[model samples]
Target chain A: MKRFSLNQATTRHWPLPDLVAGCAEAGVTGAGLWREDVQAYGVERAAALIRDAGMTVTSLCRGGFFQQSGWEEENRRAIDEAATLGAPALVLVSGGLPAGSRDIDAARAHVGEAIGRLVPYALDAGVQLAVEPLHPMFASDRCVVASLRQALDLAAPYPAETVGVVVDTYHLWWDDGVWDQIARAGRERRIACFQVADWVTPLPAGVLLGRGLPGTGCVELRRFREAVDAAGYTGPIEVEVFAEEVWARPGADVLREALAGYRSHVAELPAPVEEDDRAP
Target chain B: MKRFSLNQATTRHWPLPDLVAGCAEAGVTGAGLWREDVQAYGVERAAALIRDAGMTVTSLCRGGFFQQSGWEEENRRAIDEAATLGAPALVLVSGGLPAGSRDIDAARAHVGEAIGRLVPYALDAGVQLAVEPLHPMFASDRCVVASLRQALDLAAPYPAETVGVVVDTYHLWWDDGVWDQIARAGRERRIACFQVADWVTPLPAGVLLGRGLPGTGCVELRRFREAVDAAGYTGPIEVEVFAEEVWARPGADVLREALAGYRSHVAELPAPVEEDDRAP
Candidate 1:
């Protein structure tokens, strides 16, 4: 499908050029990239490679971490990088409670203010600062924005075009209120990016790299795809997985499996719809 | 303090007699017991030990896992055990999705039904079925009830005395709405058991353990204690940490630290209060 995207984190070991070539060879046209990976490969060169392959950079992995020092200058550069790559959305994983500071409410309030500071710059740069609410387990150390409601609340102060919320199934699959939040996000026009990852058990050490490839775990993948589709988000559906096991495999093999899993698990519709002729 | 409680899971390896002796020697009056440890030590004997030591079993560690095949029988026994121990609340960790089942809504609805079915028996047994919402990280394999709001909702439609909810700081600290929910639980008289545990970083594998004692992590424990207090809950404050590091130390040492942590991090009120002549 034209909307399918391979988030670079899914194939974390894959070289940028090789990933681009592999996607190109496989007729894939969209990608979700990480800041660190793109920077390592030289932003301009990576942009060129993807451009030459006629692929769209659906989103850039991050831009928030407001808790850290020098966040302003760093986020500005991230916005610049996203602009160069032609990515419309810069996903923001709002960093957790500032070191040793136990006040989560204060940390979260700071994130709102921090985002307000960046809204003007983001609007001018023509990039949507996509606030991604990570899984709650990361609330203490990695990301404080742990629910779709929080993300929407954070984005409410800014214009919908300038700021939006990401709907990553991995982070939100367990939430009973998430379905309603997704609908609310749709009503608010805040859904910027939709990512898919299955939740598997026996979470390894660090609790970071234990995600399952689509269809491999107990997540309702197709339901999420359908919900996002119904939410007026007709953009790229990025299959982003972060697991040591998935990364240990050959990049090409992992890519193939990712594509295959997306096809069998996420791409199918509940009932066949009339084919659209919008694509030229 | 009159409200302090030591949850047995904090010192998992501590023998029943030694733990009871340790608590008695330390002048602790309340405890939260685990089903396995009680069964392993002989329930009647354990009950007699705690009863003779002049300590109260504040609450029982569990009684939910509705997804399992023998759950009804298992839970009935758990209720009986709580009755035997004279514990007022039987905390339920609503089981995760059924095998190969991706529909979480169905699983959660089943939990509601399961709790409803047990309401009459719980009432007859003079034990409150306290529905505990585990952290979202355990939503897949351990517990699907992931928020205080959800737990309260499930406990709704039943009598407040028969069904209530557990408010554990570790499971609910990440939720911004929890403060309001804690207030709500107070309004509805659903605050059956109030628990305290700090959320530390780099969670161990399986994540069943890895909780920190109060003041060790970023959670605002005193704030939670104050919230519950404001919510009109004057119940036992159970210190329930389940980390390997905490368990490795001698039970007496851990108990002292837990008591000390609770004293410094949880018991000390922000404002001085009039002494209660209510305690005879």
Candidate 2:
């Protein structure tokens, strides 16, 4: 339960103050936040409120989109905000191919270089730059970094403390190579942030906000949690789902549901009885 | 032009009689057929129409879906249809996780064993089993096989002549590891089918009918063609798009556009000055 964190994305409409208050009442000590929500609330004020409520900002939502113009400044601001919030990591969603362009290799190379450029700034700010590999579906429009291996490889050139990779189950569960990569991410000391979200089908139009809460879909949430645990990751496991239905619910109810899902699907420590549920 | 094969999925509404006549008139010697269309037209009759038109049935649409009930018998029928159509390969889109199941590893393992079971039958029919790895977005609901590497790995245990992989640009384009895997596929003699489809953004609802004709989106079609060619596969380069806009157009007009897209975006011999369109 100590490791359970509710990423604000799971309840997107929850006001920051109310969310912090609700979480504190629920005994949830950690949160992962999105920049849009924080900015609207004033970063410094949000930081103070979170601090006052005794909640830890596990990681900042995003700071990538390197393919866009002015990305460096935008990310630098995000890093500063994360530092202010006392978050350890700033998750990056490296943007996809520039509009009307098709060179994915170049886009990926730029993401690596962009992260390298931010390493010194991140290190100075005491914020880790977490390179998040989005699902391959988002490779064309949202993020070009589409696999954990690619994320790890991008982070390899920089110091582990300054540049790390994110292991988000929703983006990675489909890859058979993810287990090996998660182990590799651990070996390299690059597991900066871990997010849990299930893969649901009939992806909505645009496929942007179709994620399911943990235990609601096909992802092996416990398997991912176990893999990260085996890889020596003892950090907060954030339930960072992005579904419209989740966002539409009362934040407290959604949080309760998320916690239950997390407990039943993710917090089980032992791995022996896993096959029992899968004997089809 | 000689190596160009139009997968019927591109202009899905084009009736078989008109499509074969259209291709023959355009000097297109090959086509990749879909099962639904063939069954509708009568398999033997469609086969005769293709043969009479002097067009080759480059491959069949699909025969996997190992997660479904009666997959073995269904796939056997698909193999027979491919054989009767004189197509040398039967493409398999391995189905996603069984309903209410989250054991992806088991689902993938099942795919391997299922393919192994079909190996003897496939070899007997003299038709290659081409395992097509769908994009990861479809991992939960459409196909569990989500990468070229996984597809090749699944195909590795069987004879390459009987089991090989499909490398479609739309599926493998986002993968940075695809180049190396393409080379590996060639060395391992596993490049069974090479499909071309650009990845358009704002994927349509359900994400199934969102592919673009060559040059219509962000995939490096010529690059994949060159990589596969370097890897020792001189097989037909099939343009296999599935877009609503494409289907709504007149078949001949769409075919002309597809041929032009293939010529400019995919069949280029030299790879110099490749970054012209990306000079952002």
Q: Taking the tens digit of each residue's C-alpha lDDT, what string does model 2 give over B1-280?
A: 9999999999899999999999999999999999999999999999999999989999998899999999999999999999999999999999989989988889999999999999999999999999999998989888999988899899988889999999999998888889999999999998888999999889988999998888889888888998999999999999998989999999999999999999999996555665876697
- What lDDT would each prediction earn against the true structure? 0.93, 0.92
Clashing pairs in 1: none
List the candidates' TM-scores in order. Answer: 0.96, 0.95
lDDT of 1 by residue, B121-239 (tens): 99999999999999999998889899999999998899999999999999999999999999999999999999999999899999888899989999999999999999999999999
Candidate 2 docking: what grade?
A: medium
Q: Which regions of candidate 2 fall more than 4 Å away from where they truly are? A: A269-280, B269-280
Q: After superposition, how far is residue A54 of candidate 1 from its true place, in Å?
A: 0.9
lDDT of 2: 0.92
Alpha-carbon DockQ of candidate 1? 0.85
Please give, for residues A171-259, the per-residue lDDT of candidate 1 as tens digits: 99999888899999999999999999999998987899999999999999999988887888889999899999899998899989988
